[model samples]
Target: MLSDTIAAISTALGEAAISVLRVSGPQALQVAAQAFKLPPKLTPRMAHLVHAMDGEGNTFDHGLLLHFQGPASYTGEDIIEFHGHGGVLVTQRLLERLLACGARAAEPGEFTQRAFLNGKMDLTQAEAVMDLIHAQSTLALRAANEQLGGAVGRVAQAMQQEIIPVLAHIEAYIDFPEEDISPETGAALLLRLDAVLGRAQKLISTSEQGRILRHGARTVISGEPNVGKSSLLNLLLGFERAIVSPMAGTTRDTIEEIIQVHGIPLRLVDTAGLRESTDDIERVGIQRTERELERADLVIEVVDASQPPSGVHRLSLPPAVASRRILVLNKPELGIHPGWSSEPAAIPLSCVTESGIEQLRDAIRAVIATAGPLAADHPIAINARHKAAFERCAARITAARAALQSAEAPEFIALEIREALQALGDVIGQVDVEQILDVIFSTFCIGK
Candidate 1:
């Protein structure tokens, strides 16, 4: 029940300077008093140092107790934080005390969920709280912070505002068919709905960038055996993650490692060389390499520049990867074959001397920058939920537009508009089903 006093250890359990135990509910202060012997007279937002106790009232440790008053707290209820010693044992014991003192253990995300329910933030902002925590790069961090600051929510709210007026107008005519809307008015409604839908499509387009920010770009390196694929991987990762050997088929599996190409992270995979192999394991490895190629956002094909080039024919790639592929003529330190000059696009350098690695890194950064929509300082990186909501919202608006154009009953058009508005509510992360009805009742002036 929401009325139940809940407690959770906010900080990860480890030896740190301090660990914080969060308690929130109507009985937060009382629970804190039981666990910490906190004085009845307390000041909101003020930290008080007190000796923490267990259920038996035995002093366990000295800690700071901070109180947040109801209606102003994170969950919009009274909250108490116990800043205790960082030792894992001490933190666990302190938290046990909180639960023993009438506070139940909080479910994962309960606090943020409560904040959403209490009107502290909308769904997007609450989801962004986790995004900010899981941010992997500078761009990802900026996007998450922007979302947390209500960037996406504001967009949804603006979209709702645009939709509601049109919905209200349609409904106004539906309630009174005598006022049968003029075609000019119908055209204006279409324009207003188109604007809202255009914004939805714009947000929907950012889903790719959002996935890249969250998971990093899947960069797969492919080539024949002994073409220095592992060598390039080591150079990028600054360590020997994959074994390099003169023996063919030495690498019979894919090796993955993460490295930052500028600020964006590259989930670099050094796959088994693409080739025909008689051995079963080698053939399986080759098959896996093909699968990785199909899925890769970027494929870097390394070729031996020392060998006389037959032709500059790059490896055949999946249509998805064709535009994102980079051809590299490695081992230039050994001396580039004369025929290699024909292919100017392939980067030429030697892994033996670690030369041209910077250029390769620069190439990677370029692909990530231009290929992704996250080039802006603060991007609208919509997660899965937002993308689905935007799509649904856009679809409903499109349906409503079709109904309006066909001069279908105003009732059907208004129904689609209401659903579209409800879909925007999903974008905001609020799922109150009756909200559309509330808008209809409150926004329309029956007297008019």
Candidate 2:
């Protein structure tokens, strides 16, 4: 595959200003010469207007031609791009001409796969490319960019570096079975092992937040009948996503919408009020609300602020969500009751006036932050694959520590350390990962 020239439509096939078709390989310039004329003095990366022709030398279109020399291109190969008309058929004609000239059709993610194979980036950066494209919120975008810049890879590399010296020391003692490790060497090894173990544990702790960034947080809004739940939902979304009414049980089903709070996307589910109902329809809605509550990552309990403190509706939450709940005092525009007017913990919100909306957003982000070890702005991202690798690395380090503590054979300690190094290497693709390369890159879109 690497020996063949490849061509593809690099831009989306739609009516835009222009669509880009790309060709890259050892013979990229030669393959492009069949359909487009390139001057012998053409400068690399310089744009020029060229007439496109088919196999019979018939002119079809005219556009810009640019070339990126090999070893400096996206895939570390000779690359050429055709900027042609945005019409779908026009773009397809140009791409077909290139393929007919002498270029194979690129498979999904082939461009990035080639980039990875050519040593332009590591596995984490490769995965981050898709993450950057599908990011639902700005915070997720920032996290993807950080990972793309080698955030987790740097940590894994540091751990590997710290373990190398310790491994050499342990292996030194392993060579001589009769001799035991010196006290100073033993202490030094323990210290370095602990240092690497600490980083592994810290990186593993961020796996939860990594999932949250990839997938929007599941947030559910619950309250008594007619407590402005729909009002709050609409206010958060900056539009009337849900119908607002004075009648209780107006909403007999759960309404879901995703809203970005301080750059974090929260999948807000506005549910029917939790109250005793006689109608079968209302009862079913309430049942659905209960199920939604069970799996919610964050629950917003809205209460009427015009009523006395004792009258505040308190919906019983599942034990899992007890600490992850935010109390909202809605309808405060009606007049804050004296009983709870002094309460500072609850957000005094007025959906009509939009007062305290910003504060409520801040509170939501704060509560979610408290739910996990995402204390850092850009926590080390370890997706499911990275998490498993880090877990193996940490487990091996722990085993090495245990072996040292028990004064086991030096060979046993050395073996564990080596395995730990391999596991860590897998995270950054320093070790064999051909099996997972397809799975990771398959999720990427064609033309990168």
Candidate 3:
């Protein structure tokens, strides 16, 4: 419905078999046809061989041209695509001619934004388009794909359906107090609200895992010096990403590598040995290591399996580390002994011998799976906006539940329900305007 026409180079700016120039709007075809000289038998919506020309009929490039008539294209309006030879100059000149023909350059994610504005997709699905494009792992791709397919939309819609009926029932009672509606009607409404809220809770739980998959889990491998932290990191990465040496101070700084365990991305951070140090540089490295452990979602606290039960037997973890710590008893080839049992919060392994690596991988996967799968065909909320909306909705639900528990007035519960409904609507763009739209679309790349 936008009055302006937009165009951009749709493909990545690099060498390829061909590059695409995308034009969308009411004047998309008209703008494109001005520079493209079509063949004799070619018609609209048909692919044709055309010479891309400049304003003075200077041939820029020869390419394939295809037209999509209004209302059936990606933007729900006329769209034109030019598949030209991939070259920086060629692509730029072709785009220039399109602009000279009155097409304006696209804003960041303006194409998808246009599609959203034209009712082709909602905000969640539109955002998912970007998520899918940037998904780093299989789990992330699955979650984003489900969201882009309107899985979350169906669930939200169903929840709204249930809520609307309850709201109607309550209003009916208020409208006709003489009717046979009992106070039990309020109880029934509360039950329905509970069910919907349960679903919301389940979805919220998956947000952690979805976020981990989207952003990758920060897992720090920490222990006192010479505990094979670097070796373990290399083994997990299945590559010599970290320098392994017999020297205790080989890795005096934090090193990071991305590794996938069962398709779950974990940003493995190998930090300097956690210990008291006299050297200034090593002290700074130790501080960085401590900082990494502080922010880690999961920590692998490595212990020397050869040592007896003593002060080092206890998990030497920073107070800031999360409670879910993995205790790893390294150097298992030295033999697991009674002393190993004395040490708590550990998983025994031999990084050099590759013993218990699979177990280690499974343990990481188990921790990730604890967050649970996202809702069925439900759009997993990924954007902060959607998360905020859900937060507000959750707050309203909490307030309503508290009202029910306190035997408060039914009107208060009804008000909370209305607030929850409106919050849910914002996620799907049913109740958004220019500012919210701007925030969402601004995250996208040009020609997305």
Candidate achieving the largest TM-score: 1
Q: Which pairs of residues collide in model 3?
A: 151-377, 151-378, 151-379, 152-378, 152-379, 327-345, 327-346, 327-347, 328-347, 329-347
Which lDDT tens digits does candidate 1 get at residues 131-209? Answer: 8898878877888889998999999999987877676666656665565543237779889989998999989888878
Pairs clashing within candidate 1: none
Flag regions of model 1 displaced more than 4 Å: 178-184, 310-314, 375-378, 431-444
lDDT of each: 0.84, 0.83, 0.77
In model 2, what is the error at residue 115, expressed in angstroms? 1.1
Model 1: ten consecutive residues of lowest lDDT: 175-184
Candidate 3 residues 1-448, lDDT tens each?
A: 3888899999999878899999999888678779888666556678788899888887879989988877887888888899999998899888988999999999999999988888988888898898899887777788888889987776666666656655555444454466544344556867888877886676666667667877788988888788899999988888889888877767788998887787777889998886777988888998898778777878888878877655743445665455657778889888876767755646789987898888888888766665555323333645566667777777888787788668786687668877877887877877433423343234322135
Instruction: State the lDDT at 131 in candidate 1.
Output: 88
Compose the digit string of candidate 2's lDDT tens values, residues 196-279: 989888888878788777787899999898989999999999999999999999989999987678777789999999888999
**lDDT of model 1 at position 221:** 91
